[model samples]
Target: MHDLIAAPFRNEHLVLRPGSQRAVKIGAAKFTDLENAVKAGRALPGWLVDVARRAWGVDTFDRPAHAAVLVRRPGPYEFSRATWELNLGCDFDCEHCYLAEKRFEGLDWAGKARLLHVMRDAGVVWLQITGGEPLIDPQFPAAYQLAHELGMQVELLSNGSQLGKPRMLELLAALPPTKMSLSVYGASPETYDGLTRRRGAFKRFTRGLDAAVAAGLNIDLSLIITNRNAHEADAMRAWADRLGVARREYANISPTIHGGAETLPSQSPEHLTQRAPFTGCPAGHTFFHADPFGRASICKVGREPNIDLPTEGVAGLARLGSIADSLMLRTGGCTGCQLSDTCRVCRPMAKVFQEAKAPLKNYCQHG
Candidate 1:
């Protein structure tokens, strides 16, 4: 059974068999072998055959054993983390805003509560609150309180527009350690405002940053590096410096894949072919996104119908569990890609842009 399952990769020097439940000496060290053992003149067990197929990268097996051995097996769930989008709408109209055409709607109190309960019960420890600007939602404060009450660490992805407002300030003052990630497109108002397509947005963003910093909030910066502003990396670094922050606090890169098709130039298949090493996407495994429609997705872009989150539930825990399983099984394009560590090509994002054949325009190689 083991040999049949591993026929394709038999030359890879991977062996599978069963023996006493003791450590097998492979080289200088002893390692415990957990595969099924072979009995005297007996057929392998069916269960062991299945294990060989999954653990040894074999596609087929007819027999089973009590134990087996192989050169490779599934790795531990290292990226077993999760991130949630608190809201979908954003206040700015940046040129690269992926969901630019989507309506700027906010979730209601009941919806927020239901979602929170679902996340809490699902053992999701990391939560991110985002929106057209989360502060726009009056219930946002209560949402934060609920997340804290449920023992989940929260992060805020905001444009910093309303941070300086009196009510928003009061809300910030009452919250616990919520990390704030602010988007800084350019160093100057002209560049930043032009990209956001809003006049005076730069002033509002800076004011909010100052207010958050003065209030002793944990803040980080996110930058969307684009052809228009790639040259400003050093200047943007200088801005972070003046703010008494580290350069690593900033995330600057262009959009390789935009959710809104009308917002950017089309990319060809040749352009979409990734030149860098393919790192496995850890979406369903480490992170997940729930759209306003209540659809759960792996990495905010996966579109396979069966892999998508069910929309019936508010918290989407079942969807999360399914996603985790799908990730473990390596059932999508992720399983075919070799770049599982260095590439940021998210399955969800790729699924969204698959029809368009968009090139990996985002930060493909980390600088």
Candidate 2:
């Protein structure tokens, strides 16, 4: 019921509002003061009440701390962000999808609710709910509502196929996500439908996109460029520009997460740009990913040695940092390559490419 959330982020304390971008950093004393006020059922402090009204337009002037704020207890685990795949089933079957098998399997509603709680306890604040198409999942509404109610800033990643539906639009309009990231496949229906291998798919996507924009929901576009739709790349960019929404293009296609070569042929070789060198990442140190079944991994690209959140709970995450360090070691095909300075792919991704038996040209500078 509360709109405000106060939580520990790494070593600092932060006050965040769901569906808003503003974050206020408070000192340790103010955090403890808020905790005491909530414990005693006292009204919020004057500064915090003013911050509430100014930041999110919520007036907590005379409101008790517990009534207006959900204070997240500090946890030993330091993760602050996570991505959850609601389901693997999608309305459109894109050829370049990373999931090799899009079998519709996931945790049931009860399990999903419990997993969200586990995430909260692990100190997650920014949550991305994705899927083969998350909007198509049956329990998406309930699960998304629960995430919001738990004081997590939710971001929805979808193909924009279901956004046209009245109920879907209504739910999002009522409890808006931080952003709706919709993937744009092609500029024309013929190209779009052909690429997704689903007839009438482009029409449905356009409808959903228009509806979302009209509803005043925050949206960003992921322009997916593949060999099938590479010719329409300019058109896609122009369309996104015309819409005046945030847009980014993805030209690199990777092997499926299962290390299958089925999706590699869709890569547009001409459009394949060199990625920046693999600098260090904060995958396990600051963030992690969760599959539909509550399995947690360092990130989407590195799935091995993951922990089952449903069974192991938050304590299971303690090993991820170590797992990440082991996964990043230069091993196998990458051992003694001498091109470590210019390596574009991380070790986990390189290992996936090796498993897929993809051509060295696809992922290595050695080619």
Candidate 3:
């Protein structure tokens, strides 16, 4: 069943169509073999065959594999449940902005619509609108509404500057988000503003948070742990506690990268050693990132164009499957490392190594 369900990735020419009822087809083949495989029953991967039979009511191999396919399809396509970076630009000039160098022009209405349509068609059931700050984009409300209309659970990540404004709060109230993530660099204005490099930002962010909470929006306080603010974790937890939010609401303590480059800081080794093992770095598997410039990356940190989906519509998501297949075949430091539990590897990392013609030691540590 594993082989059958994960079969398309093995053949470069195979393609799976996404929708309420999924279909699989091999390139240049007049008929799809999915039905044949389903008929083979016991000969097929047991888990896949069982899943197909139980889920889709397809008990025979000669029948369609729709019963075996999951919520969407049996391919590499997946969507973010709780995170996304909508654009690179932010309203605040945070000193630690990872994409500080990248411009932040918001996507136009048309582009936003296209993205929404593509996301809905690709089965992205949950999405988070992030950015330099998503609130800065005027089209944000429309994007949010569209995602909600398509039955996608939506979340917003913001520096919280705009939320304090009555109009912005009203807009947010009108849209009714599933959750809102506020990045609190510091508990106090002096410290927060110093980190953001934007005076008075801390006040605005807190005000926005207060307004959001009052409006009954589900809120998660995001913290960026770095050399300057790792000690603030307890303070942040206290703030969440005071606000009646759960402590587990805090997200991963993302290590600040030096200007989003592939190179790690001098303390990276120690940082990696101290960090807990993360089993879920589902880049090519469950999530992907597409920049404003139309380049599709497997993860937020992996910013490389493994595939270009422009004008390809839903069919373009197949590239993720292809990329995952490619990565599984990769040999070198990553091939058999037990440290894969702690190591992070993605197309962006691979691209950096491919371009530099050197191994990526800093990004992927072998056990």
Candidate 4:
């Protein structure tokens, strides 16, 4: 708090893009201009000073903290946003879970911090911490705090069950994230409990949302639609509105990470009719996922690691193109379908090629 506002200011160019134009350079003379502005009573955060220094001809390897910055990015799929599976264990037994039940394999606290440092070295600007339930992960809180301290905007994709606990609330108050996308299964206790099958889960969910909002943390509700609760989509959104939180509704269902079909979504024909233009997947191009253990993949459901994270750092990103190329083969239903022209499907790379699993029969209305 030593007059960070009045400190000497330096304007620096932050490298926001990754490609032929690798480093973004900002001149120290420009920094002198900003410092002149600061001397004239303009205020800015201490972190901006670090950013300016990193951009003013200082090599990135020297300053790990000033990794991400504001600039026109390279593409949506660059390693700009990273997703981490902090743990594969969850307290509640949800019906439509994407993660197959697996033994708990988590990185120790030091390992978690090191992973973030490596991602920062590769210039990841945004990070998402998710899991079977990231809140239950032993190293999650510390790892999350480290990401924010490293100058990355962090978000948590949580089920919101434990958000109201004394320890959980304390952690949020200490290290609030950019936002939390709290998954709300249904609008009612009966619907929520029926989906989650955990006693008092509905009460806990609401309590967690309320606690997060009270602590001044940005909170958003994500209502996942399954056949059992499809009729109540409006009610769930209404619940979010009542709580004064932003929300998004998810209606698509995907096979489990292991290609298991038992827990698949019971989507209706009308839901399958919804369509969007087929742009090439952002996966492998710019986005990548990592876990605490040895896994790294292009997408969340696409968990057959094309490249290992713990053993390989940013180098793994270079191989993503090969993985994406191998996935575009003429597979079962996609061989002659006209709808493939407009279908926004990318998981076949995981299911058909990597897992050797058959094409997900109910994935779309192409049949």
Candidate 5:
């Protein structure tokens, strides 16, 4: 059931195409799959599958599988997932934040709701709510509830600070997100405070994580590697293991949103080994980001060919495709680069932050 709800999140161009007698297609750029007999498909039957309005009732049946009359539309496709920044204000002041020093100006409740409706109309069914700290937004509940009512999968991106509060936990329990992605700073209080410059962030994060876990919410915990806390990598993993939640590690950093080289901890050679990229990053194609004020961009740093969310027509989406395609050209540093095979960095990223020089960062060990 979650698979069908999560399909949109996995694919930007996910669409319902008619196939064979009664099969439907779940498509991404480089991947496509067929589904039939969805209700009897999985052992875990979720509310999303039963209540799914957009893709449900197309040809669902009680048969085993492959027993429906399916059809496909002609060529054009639209986005399936959207990342909306409800607010830029955060309670934490991390040194490596890409959106550093941004203010908290956003549309009011009514206007924000309208933007969500637009996304739904345009075929976006997976809605990712993110922020410097999305929990800080006063209108977060309204936005979250609206996504649920629209039958979109709601994912919350947070730093896990305010989530520990009693009121916040109650609200989350009432209307849980499809999933929550919370960033973990360090393994202990001392290192966490050193990196985030907050007094008791580790405590808050742990408490918040416990609250969410206790409430039976799916959680994904992430750790961003920096010079200050790289030594705690193993410890961090063990801590997540104790909590029994999924953990991820991040060793990459990009320039600030306005192209400023914000103050970041100096890294040791160990953190940089083999971190360059061989392919372009996904900004316009797989998914796109939109800031609080409705300024839409392919990614956070590569905000080129930006369009306002409200006025983003077919032309706006087309511009995103053009910008993304331009980055794939085999020119200059991209051609015959020694780091091509092992590099995880992208072209537009290099151009924006590094003058397309110095290999994104000093993290590459390729000779």
Candidate 6:
């Protein structure tokens, strides 16, 4: 368990502490020297020792560089980030969930370990662990620990439903995430429970949220505004302010990943904001998303023609750049449309809306 990681991030060299956002930039020469020191099991560099102490209050002066710091070797790939869906199962059945089905099936421990290693080899330095609710996964603790051990800064995306458990809190305290993003459905139990279609959902959420705050975990609230709970948006922001945590609001609802329109009705029309016009993205070029089964796609929205990472390994990622290019092309109904010049949704997202048979006004500017 090293206290910090020194790695090459693309063209830059960065020294980073796991679970902390503090980053120290060093020249290429210094990065190479630190790497050599770790290889030779040398004592911690005086400068780094001072840096750790001053930045994080960590004392590494007496520790060997090899024992106290992990020096990450750069890989052939340029990817520095990724998001993995551990499982799709959730305790709550939110009406606006994008997944049409919430199955608990996914890779076993062995498969998961292999996929994570593949991600690490692909140069993923920052990994987001997500799911219908990641904390509820039985294998979460070991998997999270393994990600950190592999020198990847881990972020957790959860509903904060299971965060109140003693074991969960203890695990977070020992190895904090880069950030824990919790979804806030509502401020009160009635609206929250109603939105999630679960009894006592709000109670459990607040309990876990408060526990996380008290434990000093870096947390951010995702204020999910829906037709059912849009009235509580201000209250949700106020709650985040009271907790002294950061928050972002998400009011627009999308169709399910399976192209079902069931979730569209939950969108709060008044709160829907205009999306910027479609621009270029670096989804597969710089980062990718992996499903529970280790299927790597350009992103969460563009799911077809994915690579099976566990079976094909990291080598298969070579095809992603081309796949991303093809997915972004204006095709299908978007081809030659006069509004294409000002279209807000990307081709993949537009395809989803078209499949769901949603009204054009919901996704197209022309409507």
Judged by lDDT, which candidate is best?
6
lDDT of 5 by residue, 156-215 (tens): 889888778888888777766767889987888999988888898888888888888898
Cα lDDT over the full model 2? 0.91
> By TM-score, who's the top model here?
6
Per residue, candidate 2 scores C-alpha lDDT tens digits across 151-256 of 8999999999999899999999999889899999999999999999999999999999999999988899999999999999999999989989999999989999
Winner by TM-score between candidate 5 and candidate 2? 2
**Which of 1 and 6 is ahead in lDDT?**
6
Model 3: which ten-residue window has the lowest total lDDT? 12-21
Q: Deviation in angstroms for 108 in model 4? A: 2.4
Cα-based lDDT for every prediction: 0.54, 0.91, 0.57, 0.64, 0.65, 0.92
For model 5, the stretches where C-alpha displacement exceeds 4 angstroms are 1-76, 264-268, 273-277, 280-282, 313-315, 327-343, 356-367
lDDT of 1 by residue, 16-110 (tens): 22211111123211111222233332345444445545654555444433222222322123222355556666677777666556465645667
| Candidate 6 Cα RMSD after full superposition onto the native fold (Å) | 1.2
lDDT of 4 at 202: 90
Candidates sorted on TM-score, descending? 6, 2, 4, 5, 3, 1
TM-score per model over all chains: 0.63, 0.96, 0.66, 0.76, 0.74, 0.98
Candidate 2, poorest ten consecutive residues by summed lDDT = 54-63
Error of 2 at 197 (Å): 1.0
Candidate 6 per-residue C-alpha lDDT over 126-233 given as tens digits, one digit per residue, 9 for 90 to 100: 999999888898999999999999999999999999988999999999999999999999999999999999999999999999999999999999999999998899
Better of 2 and 6 by lDDT: 6
Better of 4 and 5 by lDDT: 5
Task: Select the stronger candidate by TM-score from 3 and 6.
Answer: 6
Candidate 6 or 5, higher lDDT: 6
- Which scores greater on lDDT, model 3 or model 6? 6
lDDT of 1: 0.54
TM-score of 5: 0.74
